[model samples]
Target: MLNHEVYHKFAPNQQYSYALSYRRQNVYDEKAPYHNEGVEQEFRLYGRYAYTFKLSERWKWKNTLRQEFRKFLLQTFTRQKRIFSLEPD
Candidate 1:
């Protein structure tokens, strides 16, 4: 598996931030019981936004929202549509 992310602070006070990320994964198996002949590849793209605020002198509060797009492929690099999905938080 491999992943990469980049983050930026958009607010001057550092209260707001955003990030973009990408991830890749590979699965290997000795038998072909399902799709991809037991070997599969996955890729993910993510976008995130965050806001931070002070709740007290010694404590801080933060909220984050993330969105993800996922893609799956067979060993032959053929795209798989049955497992496609989106996630939001």
Candidate 2:
């Protein structure tokens, strides 16, 4: 597997980041016993954005958003995967 990441700070307490990664699976002769099907590669990309604010002397608010994209094998073919999430405090 290989990964690459980048991060940027928008403020002292806020930042955004993303990552790219790739993974591979190997099938040996004992596993698949096929000459043409021996390896498979999968790739994924995702990012996150976060911000924090002071709400009170003893309290604070934080929010985050995340998104991801990927491809995976299904029954007989590959399919795209997309995900998104948001968190607040």
Candidate 3:
């Protein structure tokens, strides 16, 4: 899995410019076809800010804030075990 996004503005401050995001996930085996082998490599970074105060430009109301964090897949998947045992001899 791979995703990338980019947005930049700093010459005139287009609503307080700032945007950059990236994603990556890798795992080997299991038929191996979804970008196999890297054993999960995730790196997330996000920072966004927007402000608009016009109240008369055709109805204005804009406010945005974002913050993200994640450094490589740490693995988290647990909840599947419904009893399966029968051996008494």
Candidate 4:
């Protein structure tokens, strides 16, 4: 497994970030009974954006949005999954 991430702050209460990751799973093993004789490798990428505001002296508001994408490699049939998330305050 390998992972890398990058982040930036546009303002005191605002920020943006990105992440990349790679993983390999042994879908089949020679010693296993059910063996497909193949391995599955997944590559994932993620991005996020967030901002916050001071609503009051003791109150704060925040919003965040994130997205993710995945790709499969070294597989007979390539598959991918995508996800999105949002948070508001």
N/CA/C clash count, model 2: 0
Q: How far is candidate 2 from the true structure (C-alpha RMSD, Å)?
A: 7.9
- Candidate achieving higher TM-score, 2 or 4: 4
Q: Stretches of candidate 2 above 4 Å error?
A: 26-38, 52-63, 73-89
Instruction: Kindly list the per-residue Cα lDDT of model 3 for residues 65-88, writing each as its tens digit.
Output: 666554544234222232221221
Top candidate when judged by lDDT against the true structure: 4
Return the TM-score for each candidate structure. Answer: 0.63, 0.51, 0.25, 0.56
- Which has the greatest TM-score? 1
lDDT of each: 0.65, 0.70, 0.48, 0.76
Q: Report how far residue 38 has shifted in candidate 4, in Å.
A: 3.8
What number of clashing residue pairs does each candidate have, in the order they appear?
A: 0, 0, 0, 0
lDDT of 1 by residue, 1-89 (tens): 66677778878434333343444445545577633434567677777777778788899887877778777777677887657669553
In candidate 1, clashing pairs total 0
**Where is model 1 poorest over a 10-residue stretch in terms of lDDT?**
13-22
Give per-residue CA lDDT, model 4, range 1-89, as digits (tens).
99998989989999999999888877766585876767677777889899999899999998989888777776554553422223221
Q: How well does candidate 1 match the true structure in TM-score terms? A: 0.63
